[model samples]
Target chain A: MELLEEKIRKEGQVKGEGILKVDSFLNHQLDVALFEEMGKAFAKRFAGEGVNKILTIESSGIAIATSTARYFDYCPVVFGKKYVSLNLDQEIYSSDVYSYTKQQAYKIMVSKKYLDKDDRILIIDDFLANGKAVEALIDMVNQAGATLVGVGIAIEKGFQDGGALLREQGIALESLAIVDAMSEEEGVIFRAQSEKK
Target chain B: MELLEEKIRKEGQVKGEGILKVDSFLNHQLDVALFEEMGKAFAKRFAGEGVNKILTIESSGIAIATSTARYFDYCPVVFGKKYVSLNLDQEIYSSDVYSYTKQQAYKIMVSKKYLDKDDRILIIDDFLANGKAVEALIDMVNQAGATLVGVGIAIEKGFQDGGALLREQGIALESLAIVDAMSEEEGVIFRAQSEKK
Candidate 1:
């Protein structure tokens, strides 16, 4: 976690309207080495929770989830695809997600064949801003009658309500770096979670 | 490669209309152990090419590219984002890709900050059907004056023109499993390759 926090401080850029630009390392351009570190952290946090599968919404979440799956006995990572492809299964569990970053609502889907009542799912994502995407993934897990082990995130906008809401629901959510506040001029302020709980 | 081919034969479903759905283990639901094998194979193929970076498009490609990046000396993996985001850099190298799967022509953008002339990029993708997305990513690499060491594809539709065209261009294209034909009745037929050539 310290390494991630340090990397964010060094490369992440704070922008207006609570936006953090991490394309240089995290978002558009990924650091695979850092992803492995994050994977180890998630494995430690979610250890012994019967996590048989890793679930994430597509685009950004796939890399982190896939990397993290290696630590969980190489569990299958089922991503919620945003677009309907011919390759996707017809029988699926779908949910709507409202994106605060994109300012648009889209559907996230996972094939029913992947998730079942016997599976334990760990929801992972790159950023948890409004928590809409995570909520949708959780909804899909519920619809599939699977166990919701917990959620793992790389960066959590602490100022946002998503992390708070998940924690309020008694979900064991772990974010490697929580940005308490970020400004272009003031830099980034990460929440001190050493005393969490 | 034998393991991958076996996975496709076992879990991969052949639907009507020229579609082979391997969502059970490849794209939608990913197997991290299998991905590691793929990473090792790609590393072996692109070895000594000085592949400094792994380039890929978003969604399905992100997970594989991230997995493959680990085997390449933990190289940085930069994925081309399909949609415009608020945090994206204003300066970008963009290309148009017409997705026959989605039936939409979307722009793929990579931040100009990540890629440079000195970088040796290896493009990785989940599938190489018509090669539109891979071609667009190659174009983006050219736009940035970066060197494309080769293209690593998980599955290539050998019946399609994408694989043929890239091979004809003298590109070092390596596909783990190339399906020549498949049908609901006739089953899957793979184009035999010279042992890991």
Candidate 2:
């Protein structure tokens, strides 16, 4: 987590409206080495969770989920597709998610064939802001009757209530770096270290 | 490649409209071990190409590209975003692509900061039907003045013209398994071994 925080401080850019951009290494252009390290940290945190599958929403989440899946006994990673594709199964557990970033409500789906009641799923994603995306994933898990073991994120907007709300719900959420505050004038600020109950 | 071919022959479903669904292991629900095998095969086929980066489109391509990047001297993996986010840089290389599967036209963009003229990029993707996705990626590479070393695909529809056109242009294209022809009735049939040029 220290390395991720350092990387963010070194390469992350703070834009208007408090968005921290780490595209140089985190999302657009990826550093596999850094992702592997993050994967190790995730494995360490959820070592005894009995996670059988890793679930993520498409685009940015796929790489991190795949990397983390390697450490979790090479668990199969199932990504929720934002758009309907010819290859996707028709029978699916679908949910609606409003993207504050995109300014639209889109559908996220997973084939009913992949997830089941017996599976322990770990949800992973790039950013946890308003938590709409993570909540959508959790909703899909619930519909499938699968148990959500935990949620893993690369960066969490601690200033927002998304992470806090999840922890209050007794959901195990582990974010590698949590940004409590950020501003063009004031710079970025991460939350103080505290173990989540 | 044998492992991949075997996986397809086993779990791959033959659906109507000439579609072969292997989402259980390839794209939607990803098998990390299988992706590792694919990465190794790609490294073998594209050996000596001086590939410094793995270039791919977002969502489906991210997982395979990230896995393949590890086999290429830990080169950085860059994914084109289907939708621009607030976190994206202003400067970008953009290309329009028509998706036959989704039946829509969309723009894919890569930050100008990630790719350079001197970089040798290897394009990785899950499937190649009409080759529109790979062509769009090649266009992005060209726009950035980067050299496209080759393309590595999990499955190529040999019946389609995409693979043929690329090879005709003297581009090195390697598909783990090329389906020469397939039918809902007769199932999937890969191209003859002699056709593997």
Candidate 3:
């Protein structure tokens, strides 16, 4: 977690209106070595939860979830598909999510065959902003009658209610780096260290 | 490679119109253990190429590329962004790709900062049917003046022209499992084992 926070502080770009860009090593361009460290950290936090599956949204969250899966006994990572193509099956558990970035609502779905009642799911994602995406994943998990062990995130926008709300609901959410505040002129302000060793 | 071929034969669903759905392991519900095997196989095939970077597209390709990067000494994995949102940088190298699945055209972009002329990139992706997506990635690499060491595909439809075209151009293309044919009734038939040890 310290390594992630350090990398974020060093390379993260603080933009106007709470945009912290760590695309260099987080999202667009990924640092797999760093991801492995994050994986180990998550594994320690969520040890002995019987997490057999990792659920994530497509595009950004797949790599982080994939890396983290290795730490959880190589759990099968099921990413929710945003864009529906010709190949997607008809029997799916779908949820609607509003994207603040895209300024529109889109549907995220997982094939019913993948998410089973026996799955102990760990929802993972890159960024947890307003928690819409994470909520959508949880909704699908409920639809499939699966038990969500917890959620793991690489970066969480702590100023937002997403992380707070999940914690209030007694969900064990572990974020590698939580940005409490950020400004273009100033810089990213991470939340006080709360990650358990 | 045999492991992957065996997985396809077991779990892969043969859909209508050349669709071999291996979502159980390869794309949707990712088997990270199997992916580790793929990583080692890719490392063996593309060894000594000085591949400092792994380039891929978003969603499906991100996990495979992430798994493959560890084999390449934990190289940076840069995934091309298909959908542009509020935060994408203006400084980018973009290319047009027509998706046969969606039956539409979309632009895939990569931030100019991540890719460089000194990079020796190996394009990693889930499937290679028509190879339009791979071609788009190659175009972006060319635009950045980067060196494309080769391509590593998880499943290449040998019946399609994509794999053939890349090899015809003298590209060192290594497909873990190439499906030569498939049918809803007869199941999947992988191409003659052509993968190097």
Candidate 4:
């Protein structure tokens, strides 16, 4: 988490009041080494949860989920597709999510063949803001009758309520770096990670 | 490559005439161990290319790109964004891609900051069919003045001209599994891997 926080402090750009742009390393352009470190941290946090699968949304979440899968005994990573392609099976568990950043509503789906009651799933993603995407994934997991062991995120916008809401629901949500506040003038402020554990 | 071919032969579903669905391992539900093996194989194939970056499109390609980056000294993995967001920088190298399966055309954008003349990029993708997406990626590489060492594809539809066209252009194209022919009735028939080399 220190390494992530340090990287964010060094390269992260704050745009306006709420947006923290980390495309240089975390989202658009990726640092796989840092992802591996984050993966190890997630594995350590959720050590004995019997996580057999990793669930994530398409686009940004795939890389983080794939990285985290290696640490969980190479658990299978299933990504929820935003666009319903011809290749995707019709038999899928679908949920609606509204992206605050993109300002649009989209359906996220996972083929029913991938998830079931016997699987223990861990959700992973790059960023957590309003938590709509994570909520959609959790909904799919519930629909499949699968148990969600935990949620692992690379960065959490703590100023937003997504992370807090999950913690209130007694879900084990672990974010590597939590930004409590941000501003163009004051830069980005992070919540002490020590407060979580 | 044998391991991947075996996985496809076992879990891959041949739908109708051309569609071979390997979502069980490659696309939707990803097997990280297999991906690591694939990463190693790609590393062996592009051993001395001095690839400093792994370029891919979002959603499906990100996982393989991340997995492959580790072997290339953990080079930066940059994914082209199909859907542009407000957060993405305005200056981008964009290209149009026609998706044969999806029956649509979309723009793939890469931030100008990530790629440049000095970088050696290897494009990684889940499937290579008509090669529109790969062609779009190659265009972006050319736009950025970057060196495209090669393209690494998990599965190439040999029945299609994408793989053949790239080879015809004298591009270093390596596909892990090449399906020469496939049918729902007769199943999938793969071209001999030995014939390529």
**Each model's chain A TM-score:** 0.97, 0.97, 0.96, 0.98
**Real contacts recovered, all predictions:** 0.95, 0.95, 0.99, 0.99
Better of 3 and 4 by lDDT: 4
lDDT of 2 by residue, A1-197 (tens): 89999999888989887678888888899998899899999999999989999999988898999999999999999999997887787899999999877788999999999999999999999999999999999999999999999999999998888998899999999999999889887777887667433
Write the residue-wise lDDT of candidate 1 on B1-197 in tens digits: 78889999998888887788888888888888988899899999989999999999988888889999989988899999898887788799999999888788999999898889999999999899999999999999999999989999999988899988898898999999999899999889988777334
Q: List the residue pairs that clash in candidate 1.
A: none
The candidate maximizing DockQ is 4
Query: Which stretches of candidate 1 lie above 4 Å from their native place?
Result: B195-197
Q: DockQ of every model listed? A: 0.86, 0.85, 0.89, 0.94
Kindly list the per-residue Cα lDDT of model 4 for residues A69-178, writing each as its tens digit. Answer: 88999989999999888999999999999988888999999999999999999999999998999999999999999999999999999989999999999999999999
Give Cα distance to truth, residue B73, candidate 1, Å.
0.8
lDDT of 1 by residue, A35-76 (tens): 889999999998989899999987888888988988898988
Candidate 3 at B158: error in angstroms? 0.7
DockQ, prediction 2: 0.85
CA-lDDT, candidates in order: 0.90, 0.90, 0.90, 0.92
Model 1 per-residue lDDT at A88: 75
lDDT of 3 by residue, A87-164 (tens): 888899999999987899999999999999999999999999999999999999999999999999999998888998
Per-residue alpha-carbon lDDT of model 2 for B1-197, expressed as tens digits? 68888898888888877688999998899998889889999999988989999999887888999999889988999999987776678799999999878889999999999989999999999999899989989999999999999999999999889999999999999998999888777778887657787
Off by over 4 Å in 2: A195-197, B192-194
Least well predicted 10-residue stretch by lDDT in candidate 3 chain B: B188-197
**lDDT tens readout by residue for model 3, B38-137:** 9899999889989999999987899999998998889999999997867889999999999987899999999999899999999999999999999999
